[model samples]
Target: MKTDLYLDMDHLLLLLLLSSGLQAEGSLNQTDFVRLVDGNSLCSGRLEVKSDQSNQSWSSVCEDDFDQQDAEVVCRELGCGAPSVLQGALYGEGEAPMWTKEFQCGGNESALLDCRSSGSDRNTCSPGRAVGLTCSEPVRLVGGDSRCAGTLELKHEGEWRPVGESVDEWTLEEADFACRELDCGSAVSVRRQESSDRSVWSISYDCVQSGSLRECAASDNSSHWLNLTCSDFVRLVDGNSLCSGRLEVKSDQSNQRWSSVCEDDFDQQDAEVVCRELGCGAPSVLQGALYGEGEAPMWTKEFQCGGDESALLDCRSSGSDRNTCSPGRAVGLTCSEPESFRLMGGDSRCAGTLELKHEGEWRPVFDDYPFWILEEADIACRELYCGSAVSMRREESSHRSVWSISYDCVQYGSLRGCAASSYSSTILLSIICSGLLLQPKISASSSMDGVSEAKQQGLLVFRGSDFTVSCSIQPQYPGGSFELRFTSSTSAHTYTQPAVNHSAHFLFPAAEPAHQGSYSCVYHVHVFSHDFSSESRQLSLIVVDPRSDQIINNPSKIIITVVVLILLVSTASYFYFKQKDVTVPPTVGSVDLQHVQSW
Candidate 1:
């Protein structure tokens, strides 16, 4: 009983054992001994204290340096057993117990504790910083607390409230800061401060659901919400918005249909709900739809479009509205578009015609009708603003109605062509065309000039180009042959030139200085084809006498020179006659010479 012996299962075990019984027992049995160690050459294995594993487990100064000491201290404070008395960590020797040190919530010299749950956060030092709930003392919160997920009521003047009505997104930062500053664990409940007469700028916002306040609105305008710029989007019309926590829902109409409000977006939502209740959600395609939104009123077949950019087209065609097209002719098809669509005035057969459905008949809105009906029809066709048709309906015996127009829509031209029509209808109808209406619509058109506008400058102009002057639409000029008359105060009176080219520039010779005053060359434009001549722009040439004012009296110089020559000739002739016995000749000269000499 005093000696112990055992078999060596492995060679290493045999090598480790002693042969003698007492010696082997001493070698294998547990030994009770105490080893004192200095700070140097300490074995890596954890050294645990064999005392109450409280603060006293280690030297007060060495306590922070040992994991076992930390664990012992933490376990004791957490109501665990003595450090060495309890089973080591989990197993006796191999296990290294987990040591979690806690740091205080706030202090000038405190470490930030990584936390998980509320309990763990308060007691343990986690590896990662985890966000969780925190509660304020006294439990006075009515709306919410630091739960991070639950509702938090914000109280102003001792009244608790929910977060949404005045909440945008920034509620957490502002309210949380205020609450924590005020020592309320967190501002879980955020409510704007309200007043009996609230200024548009005074109401605060709360966004409990979103991550941030700016995220509630667009990034461009997030500050408005933070700054509480409610008035920027609101107005006080004889009263206030959200009076006594009740918002007003007023009713109005758009396109002759009732809606909750005038604003398109707001009213549209209300419209869907309201119209749905009235069993008028959206009309189905009766025939089909063809609408257009361009610079002018026109029809296009597009069934899958219902947008503000385009008018809702209600269209149908009967059999007769096919290839036979005329300006004021009736076709057996019709399309209902928006209000702003109008049939522009032009002389086009298929393209410019407007056909509306009256009594199941597609009638063209010609230039003859009251002009308003075709405009209204255009609106019905385009679902745009309604402008009166400039040309519609035919007084011709055929009594046809044509509705072809264009609109220059200024409001949405950047998105699409800007066109306008002023029409309204209680109900909208899609297009219904006759079998004859199978003819394709006229292709997109240019202006009435019938020329490519981009390439051609202005209208059909012939500047400095020759044009034969032959009469067609107009009667032959007076006596048939064209006459070019030149007139001016200085030029010949009514100087008539013959019939010439109808071009902008003329082949006529240059005018004399006398003819330069207000002399204009006007060619008749229409006169080339017709008897009535449209006058071309007057081409006037101004004659400027660059030097006439500077020539100082040339006529007097010529007269003086002639007088000097005559006197010299007379003097020479008198001297010769006196030598040749011309006393008689000298006598006459002497009478005038004597008076000069004697005087």
Candidate 2:
């Protein structure tokens, strides 16, 4: 009886110890033991740490002892993407006690406490030195060709799931938030795709008080998913400004890898897309390793952009894959910066009073030569991402300090780069551009599938399949003609159609190998007494023989098929022999009975 009682007491003590240990672990996990406070977002605030699991006392880390490596671990622990900014007292000084030890983090730790630390340096920290951090939001877009255009997904509870909401519930505000979170600029369009009920995360704009989607709720089953497209995705790096650098592309947001494109694989069309996506004027220079080779991995596939894509990732890639590139083969591009020159006080950006930004100040330009305004207006219009100058006029203004721009020097570069000096002039030159025409959209509809606008991998159709290429433009003009341009290695042909209801469809009853080529749409309209034309990005079509799929060309598939057939035959033979043995009666000398029973 005494033994039994002692054993019961030991078990009770073990249970108590385990219960307390579990409680401590639960508390540590619940609080993450670290937090950012007094900032606009959960990812940006004063950094506080709670090391002791036995108590809830929290302390702040001194910026003197903390560095970027330490900040990385904290951001990872908080489920943020990365640390973008780190400073002292950026949010505010916290009231908690200072952490005395210096954190020796290697920047790859999963949690802050997982890293090593130095001995205690001090008990009290100086004023206004509390660590403040701002981490990039953990948001991404998936299931699209590029990072900027895709189905919206957010990281929650260590898992990535698509956002779920009614189609009508989402607005431009929500879309813009998602685009900005991915660093893809502002939103241009949003689409809803209804699918079978599935588990997904739902975010409420109001609940996003911290600007973190972590606070959002997850729904068990939702049928609606959001697809968003942003205005820009490509960015330049390692050069003079945002307009020039080695090209790095973020095709997939899941891994967050920005890969460098090979110069041999990138072409002028691809350069055009990169410049346009960055909101620059045009491609001024493109060369191999011009800016400098990057440390990131080289992109596996070559970009075949149509030159009109809003983002680089929206372009198609080569079918053959090659990961290796020769040294100094990475593409470097330079785009003309368009931010310095603008036309203000006009109906649109294209039509406005010319203003030149010189030496950090925007000043009205007074053409020193009268013909300079008429001859060089095209230069200003092109820099502003508009067509050639259609008309120019002089507006009378009060005598004010203005820039006397030299048009002779403007032909070399932007108007701001021209020779200019301060001058008092009473005339401000204004110009109008051919901005009434919008780019026409080109889409292909096949018998096998529906219409698609941006086929990144290009469209593949079986031989003899029916397909139609359609062209449509936005409702800006009443009448315009659509020109379908087709180009191949051997030949080029164009088909024209009258635009009805602002759209035209070119039907092909049977697809042939000759039809395999690139197609684009050119919209031509006469408006404002000027002939204006805008072209859509190219669309690639491939006509393939369906019978090619029936042949088993892969050696692995052949081996797998032969192995499966052999296994099937062997199993059948074993069963057949066993049944025959059972039917036959056992004879005296037949040791087969024992052998069969063992088998």
Candidate 3:
């Protein structure tokens, strides 16, 4: 009938086991729990009716044991199940619970000795006839025990009730017994009365000595039973008059009290939440007591959700992080106020208004929204470095969102020269192709000053003069400052200087034995001013001595090397000295080396 009962009950019991299926002999299982509600009965008029089977009801185990009868009782009440059968279901406190102890009640659900039923109902056991079978002497038991409330069957009324005083009928001996049973401090005083009708017994004992109260000692007669009352604490009928819920120690009592302070009251932290979400109200938590005693102390809750008040619910995080793992609320010592922004053009990417993002989501950036503002989002979104924002303007027409600001970086060239995007501003797209695409043509040539005999020169030159490759590079930028470097496959190569601006040239070392063989040549150059340097176009050179027999073996490469060498040598001589020396002598018929040169 009441939905929240189960909800609360489930919450209370989920942490505890409902029952145990251990050995039925020594072990006990609380498969169900039951509680009593007034106006309970097995009748149609008092019942709620429903067609759905799930709407069935039940009664306590004290009511009936037969399944069919129980069903009838449940049907009559229109409840899910019988209350008595489910009288002692398992339950515990807190999120994770541990069930302790068995049922502690006098009803059928409890493990207490069943003594309430009559005669043959429980094998014909009559309590009154069982002479002198009473509770333990000095029934000063814990608050949870049956002896907690003294047990006395009054002779006059023939009914069981806690000992108390009534003027019409009572006795001092009975009162003394009551005191003795209750363990009250002492028989400090007494009250006597006459009895005739014998319908009920009247006796009283005062644990707390206030007036001429019937203060009688139930147990430990010397010690007073401070402030204890019968009708107040335990009833002769239902017990637990002082408290009705499960008896639990005040465990973690101090911390529980602290946590409960202002738990449902207006939270001061709410203001911090407001500040975090809306961004404008950048206030910290108002700690300490608030309206009531210990009410509304606060801690700073954090998140990047946004600066809008709507952000409060989830305003702790920003960007994709908000989408991941429920960026619920962040807690912090302090937080910065979110700035605000608005976009102008239709092509703007975000959802309507512009947002300053941090952590995860967007927050309002401070709106100095003008034509060309310094807002980072503005620069990134509009894709422009028209440097040093020109102007700023707020769009008055758009109000569903806030106003927007624009910016213009000073023109650095094209978009390629100045990278940009709505989400990033640090990227640079300087694609200036200043590097010269060059072909390094290196040539090496060697010659004996006056020797030239194609075949003979090729065959004999290596034995006579060592070959050299004077690698001279033509200027992609003529006369450009350049390093004349060389990387030979086999030689320890060196360069004069880097080709600054462009062309480069290097003279091979005078000559080498390996010069007759093929060797690789490489030149390195700087391609971009902002970028890394470029590698030179490599051209292989085959050196042929002026007198080498292998002249035509690699003639083309040789000629190329020779030409490059000639150019380098000529250029070097042209720059180094005014002119090369030369001498001429008279000759006749060119055949007198043996006869004429003897002198």
Residue 302 accuracy (lDDT) in model 2: 82
Please give, for residues 89-156, the per-residue lDDT of candidate 2 as tens digits: 99888678887677777799887766666643567788999999887777777888777788888787
**Pairs that clash in candidate 2:** none
lDDT of predicted model 1: 0.24
lDDT of all the models against the reference? 0.24, 0.71, 0.28
lDDT of 3 at 117: 20
Among all windows of 10 consecutive residues in model 2, the one with the lowest summed lDDT is 590-599
What's the true lDDT of residue 540 in model 3?
Answer: 38
Task: Tell me the tens digit of each residue's lDDT in model 3 across 1-599.
Answer: 11111222322233233243233322222222222232222111111111111322332232121123333333222222122222112121112111111112223322111111221222232221211111212123233233322334322212232333332122222233334334331121222223232332233322222211222312111111221212111111111111111111111322211111112222344444444422223443332222222221222222333333433334342232122111212221222223322232321122123333322334332232133333443343343222222223333332232211222221211111111112222221111222223445444333443322211212222334443433334443233233334445555554455453443334444444444433333445432222222343333333344444334344354544554455455555544443434322232113322221111
- Weakest lDDT window of 10 consecutive positions for candidate 3: 234-243
Q: What TM-score does candidate 2 get on C-alpha atoms?
A: 0.37
- Give the winner by TM-score: 2 or 3: 2
